[model samples]
Every structure is written in C-alpha cells, then in structure tokens.
Target: MKKIEDDIRKIEEEISETKIILPYGVMSITLFDLEQYEKIIVNINREREKNQNLEFRKSLIKKYKFVFLSKKRKLNKILNNLKNNKVEFVPKIESVVNKEYLQKFHTYREDISLKENSRYFLRQRINCCINKVNEELFLLNFHPSLYMNSMDEYIGGDFRYRYDAEAIIYEDVNILQSESHHFAIYTNEKTKEKTKRDILNILAYLNGTPIFLFTQNPSFNRKIDDLYQQFDLLDMLRLRKNEYFKEETEESISLQLPILKNYNNYSVVLFKTLKHAEIVDLYHSSLKQFEPLPRCVFLYRVFEYAASVDYKVKIRPTEYKQEDAIEYYIEKAIGYNPNPLYYMDFGSRKVTNYFTKLKLEARKIFKEWSEHPYKKSKTRGEIIYNIGRNLVAHGGNGEHNMKYDYDKNYKHINDVNIILELIARYVIELLNPGLKNVVERRKIYYEKQYTL
Candidate 1:
C-alpha cells in the first residue's frame, strides 16, 4: 500500500511538472487534465465537508476563489469589446422637393457597412487561423439580443446558428489574437461570462495560445508525442472502407490484400496530415467499384478462417507440443488433418482447416529462413506475417486483457483483408525479387485496391 501510494504521488507530481515547449515568442498554457483534476477537486471538497474543518476549509476556499477571480479578471481585461469599440454613424437624410407637384420625401439608409465589414474581418481572421491548423473549425454564435429586437430587418431573429469555417491552424498559434473578433461576439453581459469560460477551455485544449504556461517548457514535447500515438484515426476510415465493400457487394468479404495495402499507404499520408475527411471520401469512392457477393457466405468464411489462424498462430504456439496441438484442433474442427507441405493444401480443407494450413505454411517459411545459415533469422516476409497475425489476433482487444481465448476471436471480416495484403505482398516480392521498397508495394497495392 505504501509503495502504491508513493507511485501515485510520483505520477501526480510528474504530471504537474510536465511542460510543453512552443516556437519562440509564443506563450504556453498548462491544461490540467480536466477529467482527473475535476475528480480530485470534487473529492477534496467532499473530504473537507466531511471533516467539518471549517477554518481550514474556509482558508482553502478563499485562496482558490481569489486565484480563480484574478485569472478571470485578467482574461476579461485582455478581451476586445466589440460593441463598445465599434463606431456608429448615421447619414443625413435629404428631402427631395418637386416644384411642379410640391411632393417631398425623406431618403434614409442606415449604414451598418462598418459593422458588417468588421464582422467579415473577424471571420477572415478565424478562417486564417483554421487554415493554419489544416483542420475543420466550427463556430457557433448565440447572439439573441443582437438579432431579436434589432432595427435592421437584415438581422436574423433570436436563433442558434453554426457555421463551418474551413481553417486549419497549427496547435502552437495564438488562437485569441487570430480570432479576436469572433470572441468579441459575447460582449453582452448576459453571455459574457459563459463565453469567456468557453474561450478559455478552447484555448486550454488547443494549447496554442501564446500565453499558456505549458508551451514554455521543453518537457511537454513527450506528452504531445504520446497524444499523437495514442489514437488510430486511420481505423475508422479503414472500417468505413470495409463497410462500403460489404454493402456494394452484398458480401462481407474481408478487404482484399491489395486494398488493405493501399489503405495503409493512404492512411499513413492522411494521418500525418490529419486529413480524416479525405480518407473517408477515398474509402467510399474505392468501394463503389467492387463486385457484389453473398454477405452471409463471406462473413462465415471470414470467421472460420480467423478462428483457425487464431488457434494455430496464438494458441497452438504456447501449447506443450505445437504440432500436436495444431493437429488436434484441425482434426476436431474440420474432421481432417492437413499434410502442411503442399501449397494448395490451404483451400482444400474447411475454411478453419485452411487457416491452420496457412499457419503451418508460415511456420515452414520461418524454419527455412532459420536453416539458411547465411540468411537473416527474420526476413521482411516473416515480419509482415507476424504483424498480420498479431493485428488480427490481438490489436483492438488485447490492450485490456492478458488472458488468451479462442472464442473471443479475431474472426472479423477485416482480418481476412489484412491476410490478403500479406499474401499479395509476398507474391509481389516473389515475382520482383530485386524490389526492396515497402512504400512502392504500398503504392501499388493502393492503386490496385482503388481499381477494385
């Protein structure tokens, strides 16, 4: 318990001290992990109340209150007041008198062009920041009073409105300076406080504001690196591609190897640039060309093959006698055992048995590599095979559990697609023995998948 407590304290201290470095002249802000911080704050408050330590509680409360109020005041002081700073001018109305009929009328036009111009400028500023970030930025304005009872009919009534301003800004730019006018919309007293809080939250998350404390220190770089690696933004796009293929063909065939390879290439580029929407579009377009197949049959085959491979590659490997385990499972599941030496031995058995045969084939390949005294123990083919197996057998669910199970298996339709990719790469290498570039293979695979 003491050791655990010490570890927790150390982690908390490290988190508190971690700082991010930004480009020169930029101020960095520290964004406390909001979820964790909120939990801690709530627990502390509860504990103080439970202990009935009035004086101590009051002191702590007063200290935090002052700090909060002071920070709020500083933010408010820095904000630009759009309403007050705006200049208003009315044009003089001239009466046109006609001598022949003695008819006179006054012409008036309220020129809020300056206001409109200022709004446009604000919008441009926002857009520019977004463009810099290279990602989508949405804006929502709830200026009810400005529109509800306005003299100008041009103003829309009290309504919630949202707009997508296509802008992508890097995470290190000053969002406040770039979108100053957008922030000014909440100048009214009714929404000012809420608006300020929202702005702070955005600024904190962006961690790009020049005044942020976190960006000042180099230590924060590792945290940013960890964040980038944590999420697989490419998976959703790949899943969508699989679904599209499933729908188009009426068959849930695993994505073909060539297609998966291409997707990986496309994914690498998109992920590096954060172009998620483009990846989705590419997936839809690619799936539109595939021929349809029976969905049920495709899904069943996928599951059967996945389960067989999972048993051999993951489960059988750990058993006391790997070959015996493979033989036992093959006989039990398929009512037959494979010779493991023949190339066509794969498709001759039940789909599950086929997977077992494929695993055996892979093992043979590895053994051959090992037997060659001059050859490397692990070739690229071996690496790709192992990766493909792990991806299907472990990827999504393995992060949480250490125990192995056959039933909670990698029998998903997508696994077959990955396997196909490995097979295709292997075949391509066999044909082009001198070709050593994975990127070229990836590009070729992508092009073929696009055609499919």
Candidate 2:
C-alpha cells in the first residue's frame, strides 16, 4: 500500500506539468485530470455520433479518439507499471502520432469548410502536444552477414528512407553501414519487435539475401532516455560500440546481386502486406544454419508459403504439389508485360539469351535428380520446381542426391539459388508491380558494385 501511494505521488507530480493548451477557448487539461479530460472526450464522441457526415465522423474518431484516448490508456499503463515496481518508465506518448495520424492531420487541416483561425488553432495544439514527446529515440538492430553500401547522395551519414509522405518532415529511418556489419536506426516511433520484423522483411525481399540479427541493443533505448540532443544521439550511433554486434563472413554471395534502391516511394500498404506474409520468420530460421542443407529446408518454407496462397492461376488437384503451385505462380508472374527481366540493359545481346543459358545449365543439373527418365520431357516450370526448389531441399530422386557431397554440390546449389531468386523476385512483383522497376534498378546497381 505504501509503494502504491509513492507511485501515485510521483505520477501526480508528473501530471501537473502535462497540461496541453487548445485553441478556441477550450480548457487546458492534463491526461491524469480525468474528469475534465473526459468531458472533452465525451463531447467529441457526441459530436461524432450526431454529425451526419460519415467521412467527417471518421476523421474526428481517427484524429481525436484514436490519438488522444489511446494516449490516455498508455498513460494508465505506465502508471500501473510504475506501481508494480517497474522503474525508470517514460511514457511513449509520441507513438500515437505516427505516419498514419499525420496523414489524417494534414487532411483535416486542409478543409475549406473549417474557419482559418480554427484550423490554425488545431494545428498549433497538435504540434505542441506531439513535439514534447520527441527525444531523439532510436530503435537499433544489427545484422550478421549483410552490409550496406553508402549512397553517393548521403555520404558518411546513413541512407535514410521515408516510407510515409514528406508532410511530416521528421519521419524517416536510416539503414546505417558500420565497418563490417550493418545496423539500422529508425527515428520516429516503432516498438523494438515491430522494427526488427520490418527491417528483416525489407532486407529479405528487397535484397534477396535473407539475413538475421542479434537481439536489438537494449542500451540505446535505456541509455538515451531523457537525452534529447540530436548530436549526442548521432555520436552514440557512430561509435557502434555494442557488445552484441560482431562481424561475420558473408554467407550468401547473393547479397552482391542487384537490389531495389529506391524504397522511399513505396506506400504503407506494401509493408503491411509483407508483414502479413510473415516470411521473415522462415528466413530468420534459414539464416541461423551454417550448412546449406538445413538452410534449403527453411528457404523452401518461403516457397511453400507462396504456394499456399490463392492466385488467379488454377491447377488441377492432381497436379497441385507444393512445388507445382509455386511453379505456376512464377510462370504467371514473369509473364507481366515488358517483363522485369528486361528492366535493366545488361548488354547489346538480348536478356532472354542470358536467361536461356542459365536455364540450360540449371536443366542439366536438374536432369540428374528429376523423377522423369527423359529430361527433355519436362517443362521449364517442372525443372524449377523439381530441381531448384525441391532437389537442393530434399535430395533428388535417384543416385545423384545433393546431400552426399556438400563441397561438390555447392556450385549446383548456388546455380539453383539464382533461378529460385528470380522466381522470388517475380513473386514480389506479382504482389506489387510498382516495386518491379525499383527491384530491377537495385539489382543492376548491385551487379556493377560487385564487379568493382
């Protein structure tokens, strides 16, 4: 009971300084001043209920209830945790005003129906409330094998990409290139778990080298607590002196392959869809393995996931092996007009010839393991499914199983990985065609970088 009383006293002292002033003769109320704040909240709810405009009501709810009420709940949680003996707790109130809310805020401010003074007042109020929540918070994570190249545009500093619109200028994330290993630090608001998942998915699909990281640097969150200086925060990142981070030999040479360069143009919808797929978990599992055999097992799980999803192409039930479904999807994906394969100019020679050469080599390797007696009888789709996807995964049908000799078959596995990567790229293209050009552009750049 004494502990609870002490926590209550501390919270009351903090709450006294938390009053936010609104425009248009509204009373100032701290979040802890529940009775007064509740009256305002109730009034907003009533307005939302009575207001006939469906869109206007939605705007009110998104801006007011979703943003402010959520802050109230978070405050309560922080106080509760404090009472439970959790020390050094700071309210992450800034999280509520993320990219999603910023869009709504801009939209609301632009309405010609609302008086200019009223709009000005609301904007000021919002800025005042949210800006206080800013303290140069960085959610940090380190990659094991994969590293990033510095862009010519942002030399010395990290490559910062803003997924959300430029309306909120401060909202952007930096993928930093340290000495041998790479780490990413995101500004604005993201929980550590969500940031880990987001960075992994971005690296996996965009770069094609699925990499894993040690747990996030807990020190960054705790060390920077109440430290709001931008220069001080940046100095810590440059040092990169965390015990968790260490350099390792690059596993997949595929990291040298061309990767998507321009990520700033993509919408939140793309990210949300990628998260929903949850490929990172499978890729993370694959990356933890030292040998290629176990790696192939988890890598196949990604293909298996794609196979399980619904697509326009329908296969007969008898024909629908896990590999077959994915094979069909890959074929359908590559058939897009202008084709992603030709997005970059490799040389005067047609790209088809290059792909054909690769296919021929892959086919010869496939011949050794395919169930079919005659390699000539099988289609391109079948070769990819049987050899690239399945053969490396679970050794081929007859005597030439890949698992017998890791060193001898390493080249074969790599050759198969190239073909499989193309299939994976096409799968991503199918999901969001807007990314095709970006993905191809990055691949071309990476190829040049690798040769250099």
Candidate 3:
C-alpha cells in the first residue's frame, strides 16, 4: 500500500511539471475502475435526460463506452451493475478528460497575431525583495481553462479545478526565476500567507480577472481571528469590468452566445478593472480629474471603524427563553445607530442619507452572490452587511466557530468592495460640493427607508 501510494505521488509530481498546450494537446479520458465506471455511466444517463445540452451529453456517453469500458457489458444491465458496492470507500481517478468537449479557441498554439500581443492588460507591481526569488507559484483555476497560446500576453493552466498556472522564467524576468530559497517555502506557515496572497494578486492583476487562490500553505486555511492586511486586494477588485451594473440595467444590446456547455461549465463571480478611460465612458469625464487612491484610503478607514464596535455580544433576555435575543439587540442597534464609527468622520448633517444608501447597495450585491433559494426579504443584504461589518470590524470571532465559508467569504469580499467604491464616489462629490443634486442620483433603497 505504501509503495503504491509513493508511486502515485511521484506520477502526480511529474504530471504537475508537464505543460498542457491545451486545445492542441491530447486529453486523457477515463479514471475509475471497471465496476465504478459502469455505475458512473448509469448515473450520467439519468442526469443526461434532464439537461438540454444533448450534444455534450451524447459525446460523453460515446467517449465513456469506447475507451473507458475496461470490461465490456450490454447496455441494458447498467442500472443492475450500479446496485451493489454502493458504499464508496475510495473513488479512483479515471482518464476522462475529453478534448473534443473542452477545446474552444480557433487558433493553434504556435499561430499568433501581433494585435493580440498589444491587448491592454493590468500588470502586477511586485516589490523588489519578493520579486527577486525563484520559486514556482500558481493561479488557482477558478474557472474553465481558456485555449489559445497567448502565454506571452496571458498565462495557461490545466483544465481542472484549482490547478496551478505555474510561475516560470519568462524572458529573464526576475520574478519568474526559480530559486532554491523561496521565502514562502521556508517561513513559518502564518507568515507565508502574505507571500501566497501576493502571487494570486499579481496573476489576477495581470489577467484583469478574478483568480481564486488554492495553495499548499496551511495559514490560508487556518482562518485568522483578527483583521490583517490582505495583499493588494483593492487593486485586484478594481480590475473587474463594470461589476456593480448588471446586463439589463445597462440596456446592453448584444446577443448572448452559448459557450461550450458541458459538465465542467460553472457559474462566474467576476472582478474587472475600469480604466480611467472606461470611467470617463461609463460615468463622467470629470471623475478623471479626481485621484483614485484617496477614495480607497477613506474606505479602508471605514473598515477600521466597523471593526471597532463589539457587535457580536449575544446576551440572553432575563424574562424568557432568549433564543432570539441577539436578533433583538442587532435590530435595535442598526435602527438607532447603524454604524457609530461611520458617523465620526462624516458628520450626520452632511452624510445622513449617504450611509443609508451604502447599506442598500451592499445588500443587493450580497443577494446576487448568495443565490439563497428560500426567500427572506425582511433581513435585506444591507442589514446583513452592517451586522457582518460590525462583527468583522471587531477583528472576527474565531472562538465559537465564527469563521466564514470559502464561497461566502469570496462573495463578501466582492460585495463590500462594491459598497466601499460607491461610497467613495459620493465622498469625492462631498469634497467638491459642486455636484450636490447630481450626487443624490446615487441614492437607492436605504435612503428611501432611513433618510426622511
């Protein structure tokens, strides 16, 4: 058993190093053993009838039958084959990477045009010290792998969830060079997270797209109890294109093309960059005159204030069984003094309606990200954000399992970003005071409720 495990590990290491020149390179198909293979086919056929992706479905069935079928059997007894050994102990890998279904780009790897090379992409601004190290880092595969050999302009990765888009030496770039003594590899796990965050931020920046992080570092998984500086988060979030505005809201007139819909196709939570030029196009050319960082600085301060108050103290009521007592306190606190820290900087007189509006935007974004099927319109996203903001503001409670899930954390990161940027815009307007009536246009759901 040990020898087999060691051999498997060695193979995985070798496979990790091999560059996947995808859409052009061959894909391995079928992984599970014979009995499990038959069961998978049976399970797939059941699901295949439900989805509208018939062509994709048919291709899978054909591929599974031809190559994956280790011991041949008639099609009729597939359900019977699945009946026994239902208790799955260990699911083995099947070489089921079907190329025909995965590949998208028209051009081959070597065939590239000069125009694509000049594509406007965001770049990572790495510091001098960390930039000097030579160790392999990767972008965790958050979405389906895109084809087209644009490694000069973009990075290529395996067509699997959480595969590393490896960091390699490219044109003698100092950051890409591999060194024996990488700082992240040697450091105690807690300190290694900053390095891990930097790598993902750089890749996400360069792509001008949201790239998720999944690294060997244990610190990232441990879940910190207090507020700490995350690596270049604001810059990465800014790259997501027109994130707040939805397709319908923009009155966008374009036909939606059906992407290669297969088993691997997943939902996207995008982060885009809005260039100064894009800001001029979407909102106003006047915004170009005001600097971006000042707004970001103010927003950072807002987070500092949110963390100051103790919103997590859930005391029981004296009179009765207080299962819902914490809920009562939270409701009262938000209605009376939603965020005391928020009022400190911008006086209530000047920014009365603005804070209310910010909460509404956070709720809206939160709802969209959460996709919670069951309805609860009463506790809107804004209220939830305020509560979370207060709880998180107090440096997050690690004890009593106050930690957040991965998906929820990612959604919150994006949602809070939307709230902060919107507020920043209003703050900038406040400084000028020239656009009083115009800035009022940013008002949404909350001010209607709070701002009398």
What ranking of all candidate models by TM-score puts the best one first? 2, 3, 1
Question: For residue 419, what is the lDDT in candidate 2?
Answer: 47
Per-model TM values vs. the true structure? 0.15, 0.39, 0.20
Q: List the candidate 1 regions with Cα displacement exceeding 4 Å.
A: 1-91, 94-216, 222-234, 239-452
Off by over 4 Å in 2: 1-182, 187-192, 216-276, 280-290, 311-319, 333-402, 406-416, 432-434, 440-452
Candidate of highest TM-score: 2
Q: 164, model 2: CA deviation in Å? A: 19
Candidate 3 Cα misplacement greater than 4 A, ranges: 1-378, 381-388, 399-406, 434-452
Residue 122 of model 1 has an lDDT of: 32
Q: Candidate 3 at residue 161, lDDT?
A: 20
The residue pairs that clash in candidate 2, if any, are 258-443, 259-442, 259-443
Give one digit per residue, the lDDT tens place, for model 3 in 361-452: 55555566457564244343343344334434454456523234434443444454445444334332323232223111222322332334
lDDT of 2 by residue, 113-133 (tens): 333323333335444444322
**Which prediction has more favorable TM-score, 2 or 3?**
2
